[model samples]
Target: MANHGPSYGLSRELEKKNQARFSLDEAIEVLLWVENVTQLPYSCDPTTCQNAADVADLLKDGVHLCKLINRLLNNGSRAPFNPKPKMPFQKMENISNFLEACKAYGVAEISCFQTVDLYENKQCYKVIECLRSLAAVQLIMSGFEMESIIWLWKLATSCEI
Candidate 1:
C-alpha cells in the first residue's frame, strides 16, 4: 500500500556545480544597475554637461523622459508621501481660540503676582541677569565692598534690555 524510497541524491558532479548563485560584487552591480535605470535623468554621467546647447537639450528631454518614467513607475497614479496627515484649519483655529481665552483670563498676570513670582518670571528671560543679582546680594550680605555690587549692577544693566 505504501512505498518508501530515497527521495533525492546529489552526485559529486552536480554537487560541485550547485554553488551559491551570486557573489557580493554581482549583487551590488545588479542593485546599482536597477537604481541607475530607475533614477531621474537615467544617465550614468555624474557631471552636468558643460556645453550650453547640450545642457539645454538634455534638460528638456530629461524632464519629459522623467515624467514618462514616473507615470509608468506609479502606474499613472500620484499619491502624496507625507509622513503626517495635515491638521484641519478648524483644529488650529480652536487651539488659537483657547490660548486667546486664557490670555483674556489674565493667565499672564498670574506669572508675576508676588515678588518671588515676579523674580521667577523676570529670570526666565536671562539667567545671567539673575545670577549677577544673586551674587551681588550675597556679596553685600557677606560685607564685601559695596563698590563691587554697584559695579556688577552697572555691568548687568549695560547689556541690551
Candidate 2:
C-alpha cells in the first residue's frame, strides 16, 4: 500500500514546474496557516486526510530537508543532523552520496532519492534552491490565489520590483 498523499503528489507537481517560483514570505505564511489548521481539533487523521495535519508535518519536513541539502552543499559532506559520526561516510561528496546520507538521516528515506533526482541532476547545491521554488508555488497554488501566478513568475525571474 503506497501512500500517494497530498505532499507526495504536490512534490511531484512542483518538480514539473521547476522553472516556476514564488515569494518566500508568502510561502511561509501559507505554511503557518497549514500548521494552524492542522492543529485544530477537527483535523482529520493522516490516514484519511492527506491535507490534514499530515500535510503540515510534511511541509515542515520539506523545509528541514532543504536545510539539510544546504548544509551538505556548504559543509562538504558532513551530515547536518548527525553529530555522532556513527555513519561510515561523514561527507556527501555527490548527489548520490547525499541522497544516501538523507536516507540514513530518515528524510523521507523511502522516496528521498526519487525526490532529489527529480529536482537535481546530481547537483547538491541546487537541491535546496530548486525545492524552495517548488515549495513556494505549491503553497500558493494550494491557497487558491490564481492572481498570484504572475507574482510567482516575477519572483522566479528577478525577485525584484
Candidate 3:
C-alpha cells in the first residue's frame, strides 16, 4: 500500500491542469480587467508580482471587513476602509462576460460572478480580486509551490460572513 492523500490529490490536480490549457497572459488579462472595472482597492496586476503574494495582500486587506463589523457592533459610525468608486452596470456586465471567457477558455473554474451581488455586497469586489489573483497562478506556479498556492486559494475563497 502507498500513501494516497497527497499523491491522489496531485494526480487529480495534474489531470485538471492538463485539461485546462489557456495561456498565462490570457488569464492575467481577464483577471486584470475584472479588477480594473470593479475599481477594487487591491491591485491584481500579474506583471508586477507572484500570484500567491497578490492573494495574500488581498486577504490582508479583507481583514478590514472584520474591523468594520466590530465597529458597527460597538456602535461606531466611521467606515473602516475607504470607499471605492461604483462600478458601472455596463462594466459589471463586461466583467461577467470576461469571467465566462475565462471559464470557456479552460483557464479555471471560476464562479464568483454567479454568487457575487455587485450592487449590494461590497465584499464581492475583494472576492473578485482574489479570484483573479488565483487565476494568475494556474499555469505559472511550479510543482514545489502548488501546495502553497492551494492554501492561498483556500484563504482567498473564504469570505467572512
Candidate 4:
C-alpha cells in the first residue's frame, strides 16, 4: 500500500513553479502594493539589500502573505456572479498548503511561526497587525479584493461550514 499523505514532489514542483512565475522583483512590487493598500510600512527595497536582509524581508512578506490568505479564506467577499457558492475550504486548504510549502522551501522564517502563535493565542495587537498585513497582501494578490470580500461575506452568513 502506498502512503497517501500530501505529495512532497508535487508540493516542491508547485513551489518551484510559483517561484518561477513570480520573481523577487515582482514579489517586492506586490509587497509594496499590499503595504500601500493596507497602510502598513513598506520595509524593503529591492535596490539596496544585503542577502540576510533580503531573506528577512522575504520571510516577513511570507508571514503577511499567510495572514492575507487566511483572511481571504475565512472572511473575504465573493465574486459578483457566484450566485450559488461552495464553501471556501478549498481556498483555505490551498493557502495552508502553500504556507507549508514555503516553509519547506526555506522561504518562510522563524518569525512566521512566532506571528502565527501570537495570532492564535489572541494577542490583541498582534492579531490586528496580522489582519492588516494580510489584507494588504490579499489586495495585491487578488486584484482588488473582489474574491476576498465575497468569500468573507459568505463565510459570515453561511451556517453550513
Clashes of each: 0, 2, 0, 14
Q: Candidate 1's residue-wise lDDT over 47-113, tens digit each?
A: 4333222222222222322232233232343222222214433333332332233233333423222
Which lDDT tens digits does candidate 4 get at residues 1-161? 12335437888776445334333443344445445443444455544533223523433323344443433453353212221224344333433443554343333233133433222221223222333344444445566644444333443456454
Candidate 2 residue pairs in backbone clash: 77-91, 77-92
What is the TM-score (0 to 1) of candidate 4?
0.28
Best by lDDT: 3
lDDT of 4 at 67: 40
Which sections of candidate 1 miss by over 4 Å?
A: 1-8, 11-16, 40-161
Candidate with better lDDT, 1 vs 2: 2
Model 4: residues >4 Å from true position, as ranges?
1-22, 46-56, 60-62, 70-161
Compute the lDDT of residue 74 as modeled in candidate 4.
36
Q: Any residue pairs clashing in model 1, and if so which? A: none
Residue 39 deviation, candidate 4, in Å? 3.0
Stretches of candidate 3 exceeding 4 Å from the true structure: 1-87, 107-110, 122-150, 153-161
Local accuracy of candidate 2 as per-residue lDDT tens digits, 1-161: 12344445877777445424333344443444333333422233333433222333333223344343444343365533432222223312233444555554434443343433322222222343444444344434456443344434556567554
TM-score to true structure, per model: 0.17, 0.23, 0.28, 0.28
Model 2 is weakest, by summed lDDT over 10 consecutive residues, at 116-125
Cα deviation at 139, candidate 4, in Å, is 8.8
Pairs with steric clashes in candidate 3: none
